[model samples]
Target: MSGSFRGEVRKLLLHPYPKRARDQNPSREGFPIRPPLNNEPRTADEEFASDTLRRMNEVLARIQELEDALDDPSQIWPRLRGAWKRAEDEADPRMSEIVRQAREISPVLKDLEKRIRRVLRRTRELTPLDRVQEMDRASMLWLSRQPGRTIAERAGPAQRILSTVRYENFDTLENRVFHSYVRLAALVAREWQREHRQAHGSDRFRLVDTLRLRCRAIACDLEALGVGLAEPGTTPNYVLMQDRGYRTVRQNWVRLLRRERILDDLWAWQAQTWTDFAVLAIVLAIDELDEARPIAQSPIVWRQEAFKGRWFDQDRPLAVFWLEETGRIVEVQARPEQPGPLLTLARAHVSLRVTDPTRTELPRRIAVWTPHAMQRMDIQVGGEDAASRLSEIGQVASGEIMRDGLILTPAQGDPQHLVASRGKAHVDVIALDASGVSLALGMEALREFIRRDIWR
Candidate 1:
């Protein structure tokens, strides 16, 4: 995320990149109609959340607008009804409060509890007895021996006597519930941690980290209280289920489990399409549009997918960033599905819709990104022949090139793959590592070209 997913998908596009059109079979006697399918998910068993493009964007926005609630409980428990749902509606806070407690407050409480428990409060009583070390010296009974007294006690000395002792007592219901809740919290935190994928730089990671700390605190507090698993809470633990805050904790735990289940289903459904290429494309586009802000923030829908349980739109973008600079309303889109004539070769295209009443010309493709291989597989191609090699590959994929336009590709050693265009450019080829190209610089290059004839 620090890199803004920049050059990230290159891992996905590793090995030799495919032909732009998914055609172009090597010269053998056989002629093939279609290329082998490259439609597998980048990961075999897991799914990426950000891969859920456009759909979640609008839903989150709409929900925020309609409900006017930052954290909508209805989304968590849609069937929630009655005053129970409306509990403390003034603050409308029970659900969020519990989650927040688990997030930030629980951790501190647990830490304090653990530190306190290391030297827990104890009261002197005639119980929790240890070895008999001293006798009640003021009592005459110590001078007299009982009939069953041994010879050592009667003759040698009063060897031992029972006395009051002070020690920690942990057999309370409070201790049992503390242990139970801590373990439960740990389980929930693990799920959230996995969901975050431990990408610490991300906001998700920070939230998950806070929750993890809370879980640890709970465990330590229980451990300090000496709560063991062998102990049973045969009766209902009122401390965990009673009162306002305690009750909210239970509710939050259940809701979190439900959310995880739904997310699991969504992860399964993400296999329908390969949205990574375009997703990364959009990420780079935004990096270039750094100064410009989106017209409106995109909102999310809890469960919005083709199927009932899934989480996102497999084909549409995650969020559409529309930037209005001067008279231009630039809408950047990364259409992987609509890869023009280049089927899907880890390719991308950048075009513009400008309103100029004074100008009259068909909107031609401005910049064509035919990256045969994006990852820096061939560092060998960057010498005196780099330009010629680039031209040849580009021509093969998309016939002819705009002498004054841009064609960005992979050249790992070539900073941003910003290579100068030269002649024929026709019937030649190129293979640029388009992973880390400066999208803004490339776009500007096309706009401020020296030649007016190549007006794409």
Candidate 2:
């Protein structure tokens, strides 16, 4: 028995059976059986080989069950413990590989949920411009805490005085303007975070400077109208000037006071504010440049597959797959020469039409790429010839179309209800007129460009 067991173990460890041995054994009886030789029967090697194969399969089946259990997320810990037990019992090399793979996948699966939530929140925060204006108005109410006070009543004179302080011959206009606005912003942002101010970059100073200048300008305007600051500024303190300026600031105050109550009622007529959109436009400008870098590196023809199935190309380490309208979009290895279809999906889905026409003599031009081949046909669409054609189009499209006049107006007044019956409307008007060709080719792209880059 011991001799047979020793031979069986040797066969299992050393080598596989030969073709003759394989053909001879119809059924392995936990050991191989040689066919009847002319004189000799079976060798100990054949019997051992057959028995070892049967035992190996049994071991494999057991290991597979443990692997399946380990893959069950609910039983992962128990499966891991079980796998370790089996590994300890069997002392096999394959068990270690399974354990290592499970450990690698666990952390990856755990973090995926966290990453998805962050992306969703980011998308939610990037809503359209209308929402931003509404938020600004809401912020005013929240800040002032007085429903009766109009924005102009509160911020208009303050804004003018800030402007006055900025330009005032205070010996160091830049330094004074910087610190004065700094002080004013300190008051406005007292409860907010240092991070908020940090994020505003130049705007923190600009915000304060603009406010103080506006207040100072208002004070000066009141002086022009024969009104004086409530207190003379013999004091060195800027706050003293600020306080006096606010108290004495006047701008047809009687009309303002009478109509201040109506400010609440006039939301329906308030001009669509462009400040928020302006900020968005600036961000989009950066986005455009960043986006263009890759395209400029290696230009590829990308078409939008919008009508039927949607596809995106993602580059994987191994290969790039041209994903089609199937529910599952697979990552593909990108070719060296061309970008995949996924690359142009943004152009089709998102609008990036640029309307600004800087001089052709200058290095950069807007709308470098347009959906319409005609608009993109020439590199210098805004060259003299193009500009001339655009000017003609602008004249025709120049019919007055009155907009919400509030945010557009420089000074305080009831929001505009007038139509742009004639004359150039704004920078946006000219850009759109020029984009008429591009718009005909792809309105989505043109609208996105105007709304984000120009109109805003």
RMSD of each: 16.1, 40.8
lDDT on C-alpha atoms for all candidate structures: 0.36, 0.25
Error of 1 at 429 (Å): 16
Cα lDDT of model 2 overall?
0.25
Model 1, residue 109: what's the lDDT? Answer: 47
Candidate 1 weakest lDDT stretch, 10 residues = 30-39
List candidate 1 segments past 4 Å from native: 1-103, 107-217, 224-243, 247-330, 336-339, 342-358, 366-456
What's the true lDDT of residue 162 in model 2? 13
Q: Which candidate's TM-score is highest?
A: 1
